[model samples]
Target: MLDAGADYLLAAKANQPGLMGEIERFFADAPANLTSTVTEVDKGHGRVEERRVTVSTQIDWLSGDRRFPGEYRFPSIATIVKVQAQVYEKSRQSSQVRFYISSRSMTALQFAEAIRGHWAIENSLHWVLDVTFNEDAARSRTGHGPANMAVVRHFAINMVRSHNDKRSIKLRRNKAGRNPQYMAEIIRA
Candidate 1:
């Protein structure tokens, strides 16, 4: 990433157990003013989820030498982020915690926004391609078949999405499948 002059915000998962442990310890002993925090709540369909994000740049004590298991150094580690998600459904409640490292110095809200925006795009595209187009169930893996089919699906999605109608994508797709005039209108638009 440094070679490309680009910044990265990477999730710290089980693969980096040592790093994750260090991050947990760092946050546990963090000074009250050393980090910034932001919280968001979403409720729908009998489910409520609250996410709290905390970000800090106080990493002088979090060098590669401080980690256990192995000596691993991440270049340009500028911020450490912790996300705690609490979920409530009916009378049951659960919670999870996740960690991340970023090359950019960002506030907790900024990191949360960036992470949410990234997932929004990723989820939108994958859901459209998978549920709307059934792209994953396709057996066109030979040569350029997969690539060609993906391009065609993307073109169709773009065409349908570019229409002026306020209808959902699935509805628009269904209408286009049954009505030639509507399909023409979408293509023209």
Candidate 2:
């Protein structure tokens, strides 16, 4: 994205096997690198989650290193980040780990916040579409019907959410479909 004058902080996965292996090795040797750590705990939805984020900017070897095969050299990479997520439910616990490479120099806490902010928008939109609109059950995949219906669903959701009523979005949507006056009020709002 440097050609587009945009900075990126992207997660690394096995799709790029060499790069992912190198990053994993780097994290395995995090003690030698200049690394920082941050942690956050959240409790909700009958579960408790603990997230630990670690970041390092000591990857000077990548400046001209040809460790990765083919065109896998990412010169703009400035930091390596590792996130460990632990979850507890009904007295049982599990954990997972993920890694990322970033062009922007940010603290572990800032990186964690940025990641969480991105997921918040994604989760909120998915929740609204699935729970409030039953979008997952839609079978309008013929031609442009699915895309068209998605746009209409988004518009309806926005209209319902913009009203001043304290009722849920699903309730408001039901009222709008049943009552013409309420639908008119929602449209005007």
Candidate 3:
């Protein structure tokens, strides 16, 4: 959950019913034309659902400490969200949501881009780990092993990703493991 402390673009789900309810109520009462958006997507199990939502406007949803931006103090202010998703298993459906918030004023289109960029990191990092690294499959619930292994993996992944060479991280790590010279080059580079 450690992040660079940018504006939070949270996904509304049933898991947090109270929070979702609060957001809904806030949006219902916010000013018109504050935020706006359109979205389309096919995701999840095997269904596609397209939805467009134009927040008549932006409203004051920030309350206490859980406000939109964590009080870092940005200049402009706006939040936009577009959702697309799909659900399979017993049934099939997909949906996607685009959201944006800023301390500096921004147009709807700019908001769309910002929101998209914000969420794509999840697709690139967390999703990749779940699929390629089998992160969620780790079942070492015995003790510190799980936590320790997770730390090592995160460190290794960060090291390889931080490399400037054109070589793929997988190859870079393999080289580092097999050849001392290559390892030195990687570590020193």
Candidate 4:
């Protein structure tokens, strides 16, 4: 995306073991002066949550040529972020830490907001898909079948959302299943 003049923040998950390890070690060993941090608290949905976001811009060594011969380098990485969240529910509490790499230089607050916003949209879409289409229970696990079905589900969701109806998505989907005219209208929409 940097080649296209766009910046991105992406999770550094286990799939990138080397990258993840490097980030973890950096946060664990780096001096306080090398990082910027921000904290936020939110209360809702019967839970109180606190998020601490830390960011570092000293990544020149990460992309240096001194690594193993074929190791990949993250190009244009301007910042690395660590987000640690603590949540307190009615009778239980939990904590988790996540890491991300960003192409843009941003304040810790901006990173926190960007991460939360991304998850909010992701959770909303997944919740709707699971509730309205029973996507979680789908059995399409063969090669390419799961991906193909996901595309179909997303198309159906968009079509239903476009149709002028006061009913919920589940109800609209049921109506479309039972009524050919309604299905046609949804398709047209």
Candidate 5:
């Protein structure tokens, strides 16, 4: 996909033979010794997560990856990514050497936080869109209609998220929309 117009945060899995081989080659012949630290985390209700930090001291794993003449300059990078995945019937946590290739520098904490933040939104808003808002099951087939409605929904969601309250954004929006006084506070805030 990187070769295509879209940019990529490429992930390397052990199942991929060629890419895995390349990664192993880099790890084995890495200029500076590399070490990986793995962490396993468990949360209640069929939720398990594993995080890993692969700190390469000298070798630039991205060196062999395609780059414009002088686009990338870093010799090495400190990479960390957290995976909170579940396999049904039971839950277990294990860390594996799954690789992620991104055109950004990230710290270990950053990776774990990013992964967690991603799920927070997914569980909250995206699920709401699918279940509550039915964004996915929308039947709008008109030109620009879906896009327009999507924009309006996002605007509403953002406005609600900007408010301060124990109530959820959706609930806050509902209450504020029902009351002029509450609406005024939203505008002022």
Candidate 6:
């Protein structure tokens, strides 16, 4: 991404155990002077959630030649971020912590907003596909079948969303499924 003149924020998952361990250790012993933090609270869906974001720009070591043998070098990493979320539901409470590496130098609040925006897309689009189309339960797993079906589903979603009716997407989908003329109208729309 840095070579392409684009900045990125990527989650440090367990697949890269070396990188994850390095980041975890850095944060575990990080000094106050090297980090910035922001916290936000939200209440909805019968839950109260709190998110705490911490960021640090002291990442020169990650790209330097002093790294351990066989350790991957991250280039132009201007910031590292940690997000800890606490969710309080009706009968239980849970917490999770996630780490991310960013090529851009941004403040803690900016990282928080960016992370929230990313999840907003997941919730709005993926969640809708799972609920309204049962995409997760699909049986097309061979060859190009899954990709082809995904395109068809996206096209159908676009057509349904473009129709004039204010009905729910599930209702519109059912109407189109049963009514050829209504389907034609939706296609025309």
Best by TM-score: 4
TM-score, cand. 5 vs. native: 0.51
Q: What is the lDDT of residue 50 in candidate 1?
A: 97
lDDT of 4 by residue, 64-161 (tens): 76558547667788999999999999999999999999989999999999999999999999999999999999998899999999999999999999
Report the lDDT tens digits of candidate 5 across residue range 70-159: 343323333423232433336443434555544445554555555557658768877766654568888877999989988887776666
What is the lDDT of every predicted structure here?
0.90, 0.88, 0.55, 0.93, 0.56, 0.91
- TM-score for each predicted model, relative to the true structure: 0.67, 0.72, 0.57, 0.93, 0.51, 0.83
Candidate 3 per-residue lDDT, tens place, 1-189, comes to 214545544455555555456556655665654645555443554544444544423435443345453233323334434343333444544444333233434554555555557657767877755654578888888879988988877776777677787876667777778998877766665
Tell me the lDDT of model 4 at 162: 90
Q: Score residue 3 of candidate 2 by CA lDDT.
A: 85
The ten-residue window of minimal lDDT in model 3 covers 69-78
**Candidate 4 worst ten-residue window by lDDT:** 65-74
* Model 2 root-mean-square deviation: 3.9
Best by lDDT: 4
Clashes of 6: 0
Clashing pairs in 6: none
Each model's total of backbone clashes: 0, 0, 30, 0, 0, 0
Predicted candidate 1 versus true structure: per-residue lDDT over 1-189, tens digit per residue: 789889999999888888899899989989879999999998998999999999999887775455554766888899999999999999999999999999899889899999889878989999988878887899997999999998999999999999999998989999999999999999999
Q: What lDDT would candidate 2 get against the real structure?
A: 0.88
| Backbone-clash count (model 5) | 0
Deviation of model 2 at 63, angstroms: 6.9
Q: Point out the higher-scoring one by lDDT: 1 or 3.
A: 1
Model 6 TM-score (2 dp)? 0.83
Q: Runs in model 4 with CA error above 4 Å?
A: 66-70
